[model samples]
Every structure is written in structure tokens, then in C-alpha cells.
Target: MCVVGIMVGLLLLFAAPGVGSLSLGFLFLLGAWFCLWFFPHDLAHHVVGRVLGVGFRYYFLGRSAITN
Candidate 1:
């Protein structure tokens, strides 16, 4: 789903023309990158943590999670 959204955005970005389209594509790409790269870790920290009964004290740059 996420990949699909990014692909569609890229297609529109290239198919359309103008500064506005470029900016939209750039922002979409940036957001997609973040979602694919960062969102999963953060999501796991919250979901898996609680599910496994592990308590997270905090997160470090999304690369790691500190637990209690």
C-alpha cells in the first residue's frame, strides 16, 4: 500500500509539469521515505512493546528503543 502510494505520486510528478508538481512530488517522496524508513520502528516500539509486556522508556533517533 505504501509503495503503491509512492509509485502513484512519482507517476503524477513526472507526468505533470510545473513547480507545484515538483514540490508535491518532492514532499511526497520525502514523506514516503520517512514512512518506509522510520514509521515501522516507531510503530513496533509502541505495539510490540505493549504486546510483549515490555515497557519502553524512550526512543533514540528511531534506531533504538530504551526499555524498562
Candidate 2:
């Protein structure tokens, strides 16, 4: 998933500048931003935390307890 996201992001980054329409290029840039943030960013955080012996816990935020 991460690899796919990155690939898509790279494609968008490259494709944006060459687009003939300004609105289309802007949309591509927004897509690239979302892809970059939504995929590899979280994976990277988890990887680093593991390497440093940090533990993580997930919890719900709606009328429930949250943990770290």
C-alpha cells in the first residue's frame, strides 16, 4: 500500500506540471499531497517507534478511552 501510494504520488507530481489545464494540475497536486500523507507517513512513524522500543496502543475516541 505504501509503495503504491508513493508511486501514485510521484506520478502525480510529475504529471501535474505538464497538464494543460490549471485546475487539472491543481487537482493532481492535491491528490499527491493526500497520497503522501495517508500512506507512508503513518508506516514510517510505526517503524521508527518499533526500532526505538516504543509501544503503541490504539483506542477509540468516541465516548471511549484512548491510550498511548
* TM-score of each model, in listed order: 0.38, 0.69
Candidate 1 RMSD to the real structure: 7.6
Tell me how candidate 2 scores on lDDT. Answer: 0.86
TM-score for candidate 1, residues paired by index: 0.38
Deviation in Å, model 1, residue 67 alpha carbon:
16
TM-score quality measure for candidate 2: 0.69
Residues 11-59, candidate 1: write the lDDT tens digits: 5445445435667767766665655564455565587779999977865
**Cα lDDT, model 2, residue 64:** 35
List where candidate 2 sits over 4 angstroms from the true fold. Answer: 54-68
* Model 2 per-residue lDDT tens digits across residues 1-68: 77899899989989999999999999999999999877797679778999999998882335436577
